[model samples]
Target: MAEEEKPFICFKNGWNMKIEPRNRKGWLYLSLWMLALLPIVFTFTWLMNRELSTAQSAAFITGFTLVMIGWGFAMSRWMKVRSEVIDMNLMIDFMREREAQKKRGRR
Candidate 1:
């Protein structure tokens, strides 16, 4: 019964609040994000490697990294909002199914 249920993201049991995708939907989102980011990252790296001096490259990379981090955080939050809705609905469905199974098992 448990094997049939699948979720986009699974909650990790730990002190750190980390969430990861467990199914194809999650993988798709991650893959798309990586695809979107790859070109920009490559462009930055290429430009910095060839055009910037050592100190300049360091500064550019630092700034770029910080901006990318901020962008990533925002994207994650947006994605989380969508996934959480799906997760909540799935949880409700799972609970309902479990209850139905229990009632059947009793008969």
Candidate 2:
């Protein structure tokens, strides 16, 4: 069965926008990379606490996990915003090219 296509929702003025399918793949890859950092963060925290006392090591690991989780969320949001900007720029360039083509056609 074919899946229905969903339109991208724009926050300002409740506009419905369409993004190229190829651009969506970029977003998926970005999200995957962000998720992949979780295990790495866990391993790093565990490795860093090996020399500390049991209680101290537990505290350090807990603190590190919280900090890493917060950092990951922040970085994910930043990357998403950056990708949106790139998509917007590409859209603008495409529109300009289309207008130029229309003008050339009328000549």
The C-alpha RMSD in Å for every predicted model, in order, reads 8.1, 11.0
lDDT of 1: 0.69
Q: Model 2: which ten-residue window has the lowest total lDDT?
A: 5-14
Query: What is residue 47's positional error in candidate 2, in angstroms?
Result: 2.2
Clashing pairs in 2: none
19-85, model 1: which lDDT tens digit per residue? 5666787778777877888877887877776866789888888888997998789767756654433
Best by TM-score: 1
Alpha-carbon TM-score of each model against the true structure: 0.57, 0.34
- Rate residue 97 of model 1 by lDDT: 100
Relative to the true structure, how large is the alpha-carbon lDDT of every model?
Answer: 0.69, 0.59
